[model samples]
Every structure is written in structure tokens, then in C-alpha cells.
Target: MTCRLCKRDCQLKNSHIIPEFLYRSLYDEKHRFYRISVEESEKSTFIQKGVREYLLCGDCEQRLSKYERYASTVLQGGVELTVSRDGNLIHIEGIDYVKFKLFSLSILWRSSISSLDIFKQVSLGPHEEKLRKMILAEDAGRDCEYPFIMSPITHEGALQKDLIIQPTKTKLEGHVVYRFTFGGIFWVFVVSGHRIPSVVVSASISTNGKLTMLPREITEMKYISNMATELARKGKV
Candidate 1:
């Protein structure tokens, strides 16, 4: 089997689309794993672990793990970030732009190559090969390329925990956008033909290595809640 990222004709390893640690907060007291589907029928699946694919070779997997470790620290709030709250927006500072940028790109690239149904919305088309090469070379690319914005899902209580919303692709302001929820975080990745706007870039980890976290509102929570309800109705809970 050839490695998807490095194009190496080596034995492929079981690679996780999303890092395993990200799912830690989603487990029940009995250590069971639950998965929810967002299709019209609203199906639910239970498992003991995160989704995996036979994609990368051992070397490539290790390479991606480097970025994942850094990302885990950031997501776990292990790193010191200068945080400020103004109304609904939270501004964060002291981020390592290069590392986080690569981490975000890695997630996007991984989803593009994944065969899992939940990640089906992330076909990169012509951009697929480009991103593969970038990841292989450890190139994060320019800030304007594949820029992204992030927000933490603030839904309280057990009902909203460990929920995974399938990735949805759309166009926003003429640029291609992909939105998905995972590990209590909502991420919006923009595929722009032109350089991303200065304002958007500023908000990204691209400039000055800073970050800003926006709060998810009622409408967003409603969407997840509705999905949960469907799953419950189907006896998937």
C-alpha cells in the first residue's frame, strides 16, 4: 500500500482522521463511545474508539503526529494564551502561528483523503494534490492559502458533549467554505481563489501568531440539539 501523503509504496498504518485524544471528553462513565449521524434519517452509531483509515505509512503517521501533539496542547489549554473577552468574542494571543497553521492544514488534508462517510464532504479536487505535497514537505503555505477561523462550541451539559457533526462544504462570500464540529470546537476553513481578506487573515494564526475564539450562538446549538433529538428518537442514545 502506498502512503497517501508521502506517495511511498510502503505498508500503510491505521490512521485516525481525527486524533484519538480529541475524543477523550466524549466517553461515558462506562468508557463507551457514541457516534451520531446528521443525515435526514439521523442515525447513531456506537463504538469504542475514533474513526480510522488505512491511509498513511508509519513514517507519515509519525510526521503528522508531531503537529498533532502541538495541536493537542493548544486545544487542551495547556499553553498559556492571553485571553480577553469582549461581548461574544474572545481574543487570544501568544500562539505559534507556524505550528498551528500546519496543524489545521493537516486536518483539512486528512479529511480530503479519508473514505469515511462523515468526511465525504471534503474532496479537495484539484487542490488535493497540492495539499498532499505541502504536507509531505511540511509546508504550511502562505497565510492566505486555505485560511480558517475557529470557535469553541459552548453547549453545556452531557447532551452536547462528544457530538460530531459531519463536515459540510459551501460557498461563503464567493470563497469555498467547509464547516464541521469536533471535540467541542467548530472550525470554518475557507478555500479562497484570491488572497484571503486582510481582516480574516488577521484573525487567523497566520499573522503575528495570535488567535481569536468566537462563541457559538443559539442557532448553532439548535442544529446539534436537533440532531441529538433525532438520534434519541431512533433509540441510538
Candidate 2:
């Protein structure tokens, strides 16, 4: 198969659409993987591993791994989260703008091209080819292009252990958006439009190589949980 990212006619590796480390918290004591349903009619399901596909060659896989390592560190709290006095915002500093930017784009681009049902909600349309060229050329583009904002998912009592929700698509301010949860964090990727809000601008990876975490609302958690319930049920049936 031709490597999707590099377009090389070589053996493609089973590349994870989302990095594996993002699913570590979803593993059980016995190392089983459990995922919740986004449909109300069905319950959760168990699996051994995350979603992967024969997408990239070894070289492209390694290239993405470098950014994944850095993102893993940030997600694992290796970087300090500086809280504001009002507690509405948290800042993460010293991120590599280019690497993290490419990482985010890679996730979107991969999901857009993936055949897996989980990523069906993400279709980059004409932007898919544009992003492919960017990844091929190692171009992170401007921060305003495909800007993203992130928030950590907080459970009230017990964590929703070993759960992975499919990506959901929506629109915001006339821009197409895709939202997903992994590594206990919710990532919202805005694939279209250039006029990012001030709040999102502040949290951009290109903004002085730092990111900000805004508090997730109660309704947002409920919506995500509902979506997970539906996806789980659909996957099972």
C-alpha cells in the first residue's frame, strides 16, 4: 500500500490515528480497553487496543512520534498549569509552536482521511489535500489556519474509566468544527475560517509557544457523555 502521508510505495505501518498514549488512562487493571456508547440504547464495549490503520510508512510514523512525545508530556501534566486568580483560565508554557501545531494538524488530517467509523464525522473536504501538502512539506502553516482550543474533562466523583468517544462535528461562528475526547482532555479543532476569537487566540500553540486551558462547563460534559453513549451503542450494533 502507498503510505498515506508520504505517498511512498512501501510497507505501511499500522499507525494510530490518535497516539496510543492518549488511551493509557482508558485501560483497566487487567489491561482491557473499555469504551462508552454515545447512543442511549446501548452500553459500553471492551477492546484490547485503540483505533489504528495502515496509513503511514515507517518514516512518517517516526516523524509524527516526535510530536506525540511532546504532546504526551504536556497532557501528562509534565508542564505546569499556571492558574489565574479568577480561576477561569490556566496557562501552559514553553511548548514548541511548530511541533505541536503540526501534531494538531496531523490528527485532523489523519482523522479526515481515515476509513474508521469513529473519524467519520471529520471530513476536511478541499482542505485535506492542502493539509497533506503541509505535512509533506513540514509546514505548520499560520496559527490562524485550523486553530484549536483545548479543555480538560473533569469528572465529579468517579472517572469514566477506560472510555474513548468518537469525534463529533459541529459548526461555530460559520466555521466547521470537530470535537473529541482523549487523555482526559477535550480538543476542539476548527478546520475552517481565520478569524479566531481572542480567547482562542490566547490559547493557540503559536501564541508564544504556550496553551491555555479553559474550564469545561457542566453542560459540555453532559453533551460529551451523551455523544459517547451514542457512539458506543452504534459501534456495538
RMSD (Cα, Å) for all candidates, in order, is: 2.7, 3.3
CA lDDT scores, all candidates in order: 0.78, 0.77
lDDT of 1 at 226: 74
Q: Report backbone clashes per prediction.
A: 0, 13
lDDT for 225 in candidate 1 is: 72
Residues 1-237, model 2: lDDT tens digits: 899888889998999998888788777887778665555565667877788998999999999999898877766756544444336677766777777888888998999999986788899899999999998888888777778888766656333324456888998777788987777667888877467676665676664676777756535577665654655557753
Candidate 2's displacement at residue 8, Å, is 1.0
Q: Candidate 2: which stretches are off by over 4 Å?
A: 36-44, 79-86, 157-162, 217-222, 228-237
Instruction: Encode model 1's per-residue lDDT on 115-149: one tens digit a residue.
Output: 88889989888788888888888778777778888
What value does the lDDT take at residue 120 in candidate 1?
91
Worst 10 residues of 1 by lDDT: 155-164
In model 1, residue pairs whose N, Cα or C atoms come closer than 3 Å (at least 3 residues apart or on different chains), thus clashing, are none
Model 2 C-alpha RMSD to native: 3.3
